[model samples]
Target: MPPNTTSLIQPLDQGIIRTAKAHYRTQVMRKMLQAINDGTSIINYAKSIDILKALYMLKRAWFLVSPATIENCFRKAGFPVIDKTSNVNEMQMVLDVSEFGEAIQEEDFEAFVDCDKEAECFGNLTDDEICDSVKLNRQGMADLEEEDEEEAGISYESIPGVSHKDALMHLSMVRKYLEENFTEYNSYYDIEEMIEKNALINRTQSKITDFFK
Candidate 1:
C-alpha cells in the first residue's frame, strides 16, 4: 500500500492517534500548571523533557485509550464489528478533531485542535529553519558489508568498549524488572488485564480533581 493509503487505514488515522496526542498535551499542560503553582518556570520542565520521558508519557496516554474507543475507531474506518452486537452509524465514520477537545483544557487547546491553525504555525518557518529543525540522512548504504560478512562477524566475546555478556546480563535484568512491575498482573486467571494500574490511578486522580472543582 502507498504511504497515504496506509496512513488512512483502520487504526492509524481513526482518531486514536489524535486522542493520544490530546492526552499527552493535557499531561504536559498539567505539568506546566504544576510548575506555575510551585513558582517555577514552565520552560524548565518543557526543555528538560528528554525523548525517553516524552515517549513514556505518550505510551501512558495511549494506554488510557478505551477498548470501546478503539472499536469505534475501527468502525469509523468502515470495518464492521465481528460480533455485530452494537449499531454504528455509517455517517459517523470519520471523527472530528473537536471531539477530543475535552481531553485538553488549556486555553490553547482550541488552537491545538485546529488543523489549519497548526499547519499555519509550521508553515511560517523558512526552508532552512525547517531543515535545521529536522535531521535527514539521504545517503544510500551502498558500501555496507554483505550479509555473509555480517553473519561471520558475530561475536559474544568482550571488547574494549563493549561486553556482550554484560549487555545480555543487563537486558536480563531489565526483563526481570518489567516482568515484576508491568507484566506481572497482565494475565490474571488466564484473562488479559486490559486496563493498566497506573491508568486507573490517573483516572481516579482526574476524577478527584474534577470533583473538587
Candidate 2:
C-alpha cells in the first residue's frame, strides 16, 4: 500500500469497518432512546455499558454485516467482482436517520463513523503503564465484580421479572395485533416459536426446582 493510499485499496476502509461502526452506533442510539423512555439518565446509562455489554453489541454489529457488504467493499478496493449489484445502500440503511427523528442528522452519523479514522490501534505505553495494565488484566475479573457490586449498590434498582403466563399473554397480544394489521404476518411464526421454546425451558426448570423443594 502506498502512503495514504490505504483508503483507496484497503477493503476494510472501503466499507466493512464503516458498516460495522454504523451498526454499532445504531445499537448505541437505540439503547440511549430506551434509557430516555425508561426515565434513566443518559450519563448513567452510558456509564452502565461495561466491556461485556460492549463486546455483545460489537458481536451483534459484526454479525449483522452482510456478506454482500464485504464483497462490495472488496470490489470498491479495486478487486474483481462478478455481481455488479452494489450493497452500499444496504449498509446505508443500517443507520436509519429517520428512526432517530431530529435528534440525529445524516451528517452526525457520518461524522461519528469518520471520527476515529486517524486513531491508532496500538500506542506506545510507559513502563509503569504497561506494568499497571498487566496487573489489571491479572485481577481484572475480581476487580470488575467488586466495582459492579459497588456501583449496583449506588444506582441499581431491581425490577421484578415477568411471569411466564404474562409473557405468553403479551406475546399472544402482539401476534394478534400483527395478524390484524399486517397482510404479511408470517414473520410472527418465528417469534411465536421462540417464545414457545423459552416457555418450555422455563417450565422444565420450574419442575426441577419443585422436585428439589
Candidate 3:
C-alpha cells in the first residue's frame, strides 16, 4: 500500500473503458488525425471540421460530450483551434487550433462522427419514434434517405468554410493570392510555398470568417 500507483492507474484506465462516451471520444479523435494527414496544406482547417463535426454528432446522438476536455484533447494532439475566450462568447466555443507542428491523431475521432450523424438522422428516440419522426412529412422521408447515404462519410455541411466544393475553390484562389503576394509574406509564413499554392482564404479572412461564423 505504499502509494498504490496501480490502484490509481486502474481507475484511470477503467474509467476510460467503462464509460461508453469516453470510448466514442477516443474513436473520433483518431479519425480527425487521419483527416489532417490528407496533405491539404491547410490541414488545421480540415482538422477543425473533424472535431466540430464530432462534437455535434456526439450531442445529436444523445451522448453528452465534455466541450472543455474535448477542446483540450484536440490541442494536446497538436491541431490548433481558436476556441472561445470566455463563456460569454458561446459562439466561439468550438474552434480549430492547428497553427503549429504537424497534427497528431485524435484517439476516438470516428465514433464522435458516427454519433453526430445518427443523432441528425435517427436521434435518441426508439426505432419507431425515429420512423414516426420521419413519417410526419414527405420532405422528412427524403431527408432521412439522403442522410443515410451521407451518414457514413464526413459531415462537412455543418462546418463553415468546409464544403469540398468551396474548399477546392478557395484553395485555388488562395494559391493565386499567394503568388501575387508571396514576396510580402516570406518572412512571416513558414509554408510560403504552400500558402502560395494551396490556401484559399488568407489568414486574416480565415481567422475573421471563422471567428464570426
Q: lDDT (0-100) at residue 95 of candidate 2?
A: 63
The regions of model 3 sitting more than 4 angstroms off are: 1-18, 40-134, 137-141, 144-213
Please give the lDDT score for candidate 1: 0.57
TM-score of each: 0.44, 0.67, 0.21
Ten-residue stretch with the least lDDT total in model 1 = 136-145
Each candidate structure's count of clashing pairs = 0, 0, 22
Q: Rate the local accuracy (lDDT) of all candidates.
A: 0.57, 0.82, 0.47
Model 3, span 1-213: residue lDDT tens: 233344332322222222335444444554555555665344564445654686775664334334544454444445466974423222122222232224432323333323543342222568987787677876876786589568756554654665545655676676678778776645334444455555455434446667776
Q: Candidates sorted by TM-score, descending order?
A: 2, 1, 3
Summarize candidate 2's per-residue lDDT along 134-204 as a digit string, tens digits. 98887997787679778768524465777777877898999789878888987678877877888788775
Q: How much is 50 displaced in model 2, in angstroms?
A: 2.9
TM-score of 2: 0.67
Higher-scoring candidate on lDDT, 1 or 3 = 1
Kindly list the per-residue Cα lDDT of model 1 for residues 1-213, writing each as its tens digit.
343355456474676766666667666666776776788886787766877889988898888766666777787777878755544332132233354345444445745544442342223568987686554322222223244346668533422653444555565666677778885643342322222333345453346567777
RMSD of each: 17.9, 5.1, 19.6
Best by lDDT: 2
> Which numbered prediction scores highest in TM-score against the true structure?
2
